[model samples]
Target chain A: MAESMTFLDHFEIWLRAYLILSLFSFLYKDNRFYKLSEHVFAGLSAGYYVGLIWQTVIVQQLINPMFDEGEWVLIIPGMLGVLMFARLVPKWSWVSRVSLAFVIGNTAGIYLMNALHGLIFKQLYATMGSISNSNGFAGVLLALVVVVGVISTLVYFYFSKEHKGVVGVTAKVGIWFIMIAFGAHFGFTVMGRISLLIGRAEFLFYEWGGSLGQIF
Target chain B: MRNTLPVIIAFLAGIAMVISFFFNPERTVLGTFQENLLQWVTIVGGFTLVLGVFSIVRVNARAVSRRSDGWFYKLATVISVFAMAIPSIMPTSANSAFGKVFYSIFPISWAGAFGTGPDSIYDWLFNYVDSPMMETMFATLAFYIASAAYRAFRARSAEETLLLITACLVMLWRVPIGEALLRSIDVRIPDYINMFVMNGFNLSVQRGIIIGAALGMASMSLRILLGIERTYMGKG
Candidate 1:
C-alpha cells in the first residue's frame, strides 16, 4: 500500500497529521500553530456552509425549479431570501423584519404542535402506561420509582408555591433525583469524550505513525 | 406599517402552518401550501448563513485593514473563507458556460471542483484539514472533563455524596473493565444501577424536563402566533 501511495496521498496524510498535532498542541498550552489551525478551521467550516447552501438551496432548489420546471412561485421565497440582505443597509434594515417574521412564525407553528403532540402528551402517556404495564415485582418497583421521581421533580420546579410543607419533602426528593440524573449525564458525557480521545489517539498512532514507518 | 405588517405576516404564516398539520397534503391544497412555505423557510434560512459569512468577512477584513492585534490571523481567516468558498461555488462541469470560462482561466484539471464530489477541493480540505481539526478539538474536551471531575467529585454533603456515588457507578458501568469488575463483586450491582438509577430516576427527570420545556414552547409559540411576541421583529 505504501509503495502504491501517490504524492497527493502522502501530502494528504501529512496535512491531516499536521492539523491533528497542531490542534492537540492546545492541550499543553496555546501556541501560534494552534491559533492558526483554529482560525483555518473556523474559516473552512463557514466556507463549507456557504458553498453548501448556495448549491443546495439557491441553485438546486430555487433557480433550477424556477427556470427548468417553470415553478415561478418559488420566486416569492427567492425574493424573501434576497430581502434578508437588507440588513447590510442600515436605512432599510427594518425591511428584513418581513423575512425574519416568516421564519420565526413558521418555526413557532411547528414547535407548538410538535411540543403538544410529540413531547408532552407522549411523555405523560408513557409515564402512565409504565405503571399499569409492569410485568413483575422488579418492574413494579421500577415503575413506582419513575412515578415518584416524575412527581417530585415536577414539584421541585413548581416555585409558585412555598416549599414549607409536604411539597418541601417532595421537593427534597426531587433534588436527590435531579442530582443523580445530572451525575449520570456527566458520566455519559465523560465516556463519550474518552471515546473521541481514544479515536484521535488511535488515528495518530496507527494511521499517521504507521504510514511514516511504511513510507520509510 | 413596518411593525404592523410584519406582525400580520407572522400571524398568517404561523396559522397556515398550524392548519396544514391537521390536513393531508395528498388530498388538500393545504399540503401544497405547507410544502411551499417550508421551501420558502429553507431558502430564507440559507440566506442567514450568507449573512453570517458576510459578517465574518467584514469583521476580519476590518481588523486586517486596521492592523489590529492578531491581524495576521484575521487575514488568514479572510483568505481561507474566500479560498474555500469561491472554488466550492464555481461551476463543476466544463460543459457549462461558466465552467468553460472558469476552467479556461484556471486549470482544466480543476473541473468539477464543487464541494460535493469525491475529487473536489472542498471535499479534500474537509477530509484532511477540517475534519481532523474538529475531531482533535472535541477530543481535547476529555482532558478538561477529567480535570473538572477531579475538582467537582468531592463528597461534601449528602446530596454531593449521592451525586459522586452515582457518577462513579455510572462511569464504572459504562466501561467494559468496570462492568467486569462489578460483575465479579455482584452481577446484580450493575443491573440494579442500570434499572434503578438510569431507567427509573433518569428517565423520570428527563420526562419532567421534556414536559416542562414543551409547555413553555407551546406557550411561547401561542404568544408569537398572537403577535404578542414581537421581540423577534426587533425594536422600532
Candidate 2:
C-alpha cells in the first residue's frame, strides 16, 4: 500500500504525520512545534467555517433566493444579520439588541416546546412503560430499580422543602444513584478518549511508520 | 425605544414560532412563515461567524504588531486562516474567469479543482493539518483522565464506594482484556453488569436528570419570551 502511493499522497501522509507528532509533543512539554500546530489548527478550523457558512448560508440560503428565485422578503433577515455588527460601534451598540432579541426569542420558543414534548413527556412515558414491559423476576426487579431510581433522583433535586423524614431518605437514595450514574459516565468518557488515542497511535505506527520503513 | 422595541421583537418572534408548531404547514401561511423564519435565523447566525473571524484577525493582528511573546504563533494563525479561507471561497471550475486567472497566476498543476472540493487547498489543509491536530488534542485527554481517576476515585463514603465499584465494573466491561478476564470468572458476569448497572441504574438516573433539565429549560424559555430574561441583552 505504501509503495502504491502517488507524490501527492506521500506529501499528504508526511504532512499529517508531522502535524500529529507536533501535537503529541505537548505530552512531553509545550514547545514551538506544538504552539505552531495549535495556532495553525485554530486558524484553519475558523477558516473552514468561513467557507462553509459563505457557501451554504450566505449564497445558498440568502443571496440565491433573494435574487434568482425572487424571494425579496429575505432582505429583512439579511438586514437583521448586518445589524449584529452594530456591536462594534459604541454609541450604536444598542441597535444590535433587536437582532439578538430575535435570535434568542426564536431559540427560546423552539427550546420550550421541545423540552415539554421531546424530553419531559417522553421520559415520563418511557419510565411508566418499562414497568409494564418487564418479562421475568429479574426483569421485574430491574424495572422496580428504574422506577425507584428515577423517583429518588427527582426527589434529590427537589429543594422546596428541607431535607427531613421521607424526603431525606429518598434524597439520600438519589445521591447514591447519581454517584453510580456519574461513575458510569466517567468510565464511558475514558473509553472514548482511549479509543481516540488508539486511532492516532494506529495512524502513526501503520501509516507514517510503515511509509518510513518502505522509504529506507 | 432601544429597550422596549427589542423586547417586543423578541416576544413577537417567539410567539410566532410557538404558534407555528400547532398549525399544519400544508394548510396555513404560518408554516411558510415558520420555514422562512428558520432560514432567516440561519442566515443571521452565519454572520456571527463573520464577526468571529473579524475578531480573531483583529486580536492576532494587534498582538503581532506589538511583537507579543507568542506573536509569531499568532502570525502563523492569521496566515493559516487566510490560506484556508481564500482558496475555499474562490471558484473551482477552471473554465470560469476567476479560476482561469487564479490557476494561471498560482500555476499549481496538482490542484485539480478549487473551492471546498477534493484536491483543493482548503480540503488538503483540513485533512492533513486541522484534523490530525484535533484528534491528537482529544487523544491527549486520556492521560489527564488517568491522573484525575487516580486522585478522585477514592472510596471514602458509601456513595463514593458505590461510584468506584460501578466505575470499575464499567471500565472492565468496556475493554477487551478486562471483559475476557471477567468471562474467565463467569461468562454471564459481563452481561449482568451490562443489564443491571448500566441499563437499570444509569438509564433511570439519566431520565430523571433529563426531565429536570427540560423543566428548567422550559421555565427559562418562558422567561425569555415574557421579556423577563433581559440578561441576554447586554448592559448599556
Candidate 3:
C-alpha cells in the first residue's frame, strides 16, 4: 500500500498530526504546547464567528434593508448599536445608558415569567404526576416522603430566627437529605470527569498512534 | 456607562432567552427580540474575546522577549494563530482554493470527514477511532462506578450504617448475579423489595435530584443575566 507522496500531501499530513497531537498534550499537562494550541484554537474560533456576524448582520440584515429592500426597521437597533460606540467619546458617554436600561428591563421581564411558569408550575405538576400512579401504603408513604423532602429543603433556607422548634428538626433532616443528594451528584460528576479523561487517552493511544495504539 | 452595562445586557438577554421558551411563546415579537438581542450580544462578545487574544499576545510576547524556558511555544502560538486567522482574513490561501476544488470531487463532502465519501480518511477515523473513543469513554463509567461504590460504602455511625446497608443491597440488586442471589434468599422478598420497593424509591430520588439541579442552574443563570454575578466576565 506504500505510495509516493507530493509536497502538499506531506504538508497537510504534518499539519493534521500537529494539531491533533498538540490538543492531546493538555492531558499530559497544561504545558506551553497545550497553551499554544489553545490560543490558536480560541483565536481561530473567535475570528470565524466575527466573520459570520459581519456576513449575517452587515450583509444580510443591514445592507439588505438599506440597499436591497429599502426598508428602515433594521436601522432602529443599528442606531442603538452606534450609541454604544459613544462611550469612547469625551462628552457623549451617557448615550449608552438608555441602551443599557432597555436591555435590563427586557431581560428581567422575560426571566420573571420563566421562573413562575417553567420552574414553579412545572415542578408542582411533576410532583402531583409522580403520585398519580402510586397506590397502596407504600405509594402513600413515598409521596409523603417526597413532599417532606421538598418542603424541608426549602425550609432549610429560612434564617429568620433560632430553628428551635419544628423548623429546626425539619432543617436537620433536610441537611441529611441534601448531603446524600450531593453525594449522589458527586458520584455522577466524578464518573463524567474520568470518562472525559479516558476519551483523550484513547485518542492519544489509538487514532494518531494508528496500528501501534491498538496494541493495548 | 461602561462595558459593565453591556455585560448586564448580555446576562439579562440569556435569561430572557430561557424564559421566552416557557411563557412568552405567544409573544412572537419577544422571541424575535431575544434572538436579536443575543445576536448583538454575541457580536459584542466577539470583540471582548479579541481583547483576550490581545492580552495573550501581550503576556506571551513578554515571555518570549524575556527568553522563558519554552519561548518556542509563544512563537508557535503566534504562528498557528496567524496561519488559521490569516487564511480567513486574506482568502487567497491554497487551502481555501483546495477546498473549493475538491468540493466537487466527492459525492457528499459537506458535513464532515464521513460526508466526504465512503472511502474517505474521515470516514475511517470516524468509524475506527472517534466513535470507539467516545463509546469507550462512556463505558469506562461502569468500572469507575463500581470502584466508587466499593470505596465510598463504609459504616461509621447510624446514618453511615444505613447508607452502607442500602448501597450494598442496591448494588447487589443491579447485577444479574445479585438478582440470582436475591432470588435464592426468598422469591417474594426479592420480587417485592428489590423490584418494587428499592427500584421505585431510587428512581424517584434520582428524578428529584435532576429537577433540583435544573432549577438551581436556571436561578444561577438568571442571576448571571441580571448582573448579580460577574464571574463569567473574568478579571477584566
> For residue A130, what is the lDDT in candidate 1?
97
User: What DockQ does every candidate get?
Assistant: 0.80, 0.79, 0.15
Q: Write the per-residue lDDT of candidate 2 for residues B38-88, one digit (tens) a residue.
A: 888888888888878878988998999999999999999999889888877
Clashing residue pairs in candidate 3 (N, C-alpha, C atoms within 3 angstroms): B11-B225, B12-B225
**Fraction of true A-B contacts recovered by candidate 2:** 0.79
**Residue-by-residue lDDT tens digits, candidate 3, A100-174:** 444444554555556556666787676777577668897777676666666666666557766778999987776
TM-score of 2: 0.94
Per-residue C-alpha lDDT of model 2 across residues A1-216, encoded as one tens digit per residue: 555777777787899989988888888998999999999999998899888877777767887687778999989999998999898788998998999999998999999899998899999998999899999999999999899999999999999998789999999999988999988998898899889999999998888887787676
Worst 10 residues of 2 chain B by lDDT: B106-115
- The candidate, 2 or 3, that scores higher on DockQ is 2
RMSD in angstroms between candidate 2 and the native structure over all alpha carbons? 2.3
What lDDT score goes with residue B225 in model 2?
95
DockQ of 2: 0.79
Rank the models by DockQ, top first. Answer: 1, 2, 3
Residue A124's lDDT in candidate 2:
93
Per-residue lDDT value at A68 in model 1: 73
Write the residue-wise lDDT of candidate 1 on B1-236 in tens digits. Answer: 89888888888888898898898877998988888888899989899889899889999999999999999999888888887898788887676567689778888766757656687888877888888889999999999999998886798899988888888889999989999999999979899988989999999999888888898999999999899989986665
